[model samples]
Target: MAGSLGPGSGWTAAVRRLLRQFSSAQRPGSPGFQGLPLLVEGQQVGLVVPAVARELRAFPNVFVEVTGGLELRGGHCPEERTEAVAGVLAQLRAEGRLARLARWRDEAYEVRPSFGAPALLNVERAAAPLLGVLQFGAHLNAFVCRQDDETGSWQIFMWLARRSPHKATYPGLLDNLAAGGISAGLGVKETMVKESWEEARVPPKLAAQAQPVGCLSFTYEEMDGEEFGAVVRECLFIFDLEVPEDFTPQVGDGEAQEFYLWPLNKVREAVNSGSFKPNCALVVVDFLFRHGLLHPDHEPLYPELMAVMHQTL
Candidate 1:
């Protein structure tokens, strides 16, 4: 597939831009004060400033004492703090303070001090608007891709899932075969398997065969509401699964509308056509590179693109 796609193609540029935006080396040059310090167990996690954080401080469910930075304490343990924040977000949703933001999964994800190892605390996925403002390192994405060599020419096809129209964010967008956030109390592989079953109806046996490819990290400022917004720092754990040629993915959950198996050219077209979610588009580009479907000589900026994509989080 090397040199099959010409350099300077619009899709190639789009893919390159996606890779650059998500890389830490291309960090946004913003004033430091835009984000508030997020502290868990007295340690800094991220910076957030969603209105919900102010509400969190005002709510009595969780102890919010501000000594140097905003801290989630007064709860006996991390669970307590998590419960307190979830409750607060739920109430805000009910009161209409948070509208579409509430449509995210209700599950909680573990927020770590940095990348891996020890976890600091857990928070609701929807409440990420609040935490995202703090730029907490809790947000994570697990992407599952299926590789098919049915063409018998060593050609590859990837299975893609279309998001449900009812989804709050990126509704009806194309996504990976199975993708989800790494919820609190769930490991990367665990979340991948769970999402695989829920989103693609993949049998546990099949899901278990998935292998971790690598991780992509990026931080972007996002507006959660008209009045509230936060800088979001996220890491996506990418995985690849080799599947039988005849295998088809069914939607077990309402999260996705349907699944489609697309060839490399079609995948590239869909990604550059703006049919896929921004993050998913990036994942697809990474997929192309890892699978050797996209070659270094295909693009003039190949070296720069690969360098940014391969940078360690």
Candidate 2:
């Protein structure tokens, strides 16, 4: 794998370009792109673009425009703040103010100053990006290992899921073995187990074997066809689950249409071909780096790739 991924590899440019796509959030002081900080209880939690801010201004009792940013207004407690913001979001959805709100999940995501901090509030999953709040999720890289008879070495095969065509976002795109948002009140492992079962029929006991790996984070702008848009800041908690050679994942909740156990090379090819969902491609790149498929000695942009994938959010 390392040999195939050297400096002159044809896929190098594609992989580099994909990483840049997710890390494309405009930096502070960039001309023509400015996002107002969304604060809660005096703590900055998200960034609201001008258009959304204007829409939010309609609900003065809920959204407060301050000197340089916007603030969520209500009682200090998380529940109160959540209720206050949720009502406004639901109203906006009903009015068709933002296009992305059409895919409301009714699921809540904890808004925090930072990961592991006490929750500032719980906002609907669809509203997290709109509010520019930090969103957390778990992704599992399920693989099987087998002994290569001729080379007398081990080989890895990864399981890739084709998302259901009926999905609201990224329908029919390739995804990690199982991935899901860390909804309010659920820990990383718990979400992993739930997603593993829902997207693929990995049993609780098998899913429990997943090992907690590092994370990938990025802040990118997502715009609707109209003026409404979002600054999406996201962190994905990654996990690796090694399954038995004979274990075949069955579709559990229809989130995934089917699964494929592809060799590591094939997985890399798919990632380079832009077949995997954007973020999932980053996860796979991280996987390759961890498993020695991508190495600094061979890949010219190794250091930059590593830094960009783990950007601070």
Estimate the TM-score of every prediction: 0.81, 0.96
lDDT of each: 0.67, 0.88
lDDT of 2 by residue, 1-313 (tens): 2233454345787767876787677856778668999888888999888898999999999888998899888767888988898888989999898998999998999999999799988989998888899999999999988887787777788999999999998889899999999999999999999999988989989999999989998888888976888998989999999999888999988999999999888888887777888889889999989988887778877888887788888
lDDT string for model 1 (1-313, tens) is 3225454346765766576565422232444444566777767776666364666677754636475457766466766766676677777778877654557576667766776547666776666645752222211122324434664344566788889998888999998888887766667788888888888888878888888888766666556557676556667788888787678889888999998887667778887778988877877877777767667666666776666554432
User: What TM-score, to 2 decimals, does candidate 1 have?
Assistant: 0.81
Assess the local accuracy of residue 258 in candidate 1 as a C-alpha lDDT between 0 and 100: 91
- Alpha-carbon RMSD to native, per candidate: 4.5, 1.6
- Global Cα lDDT for candidate 2: 0.88
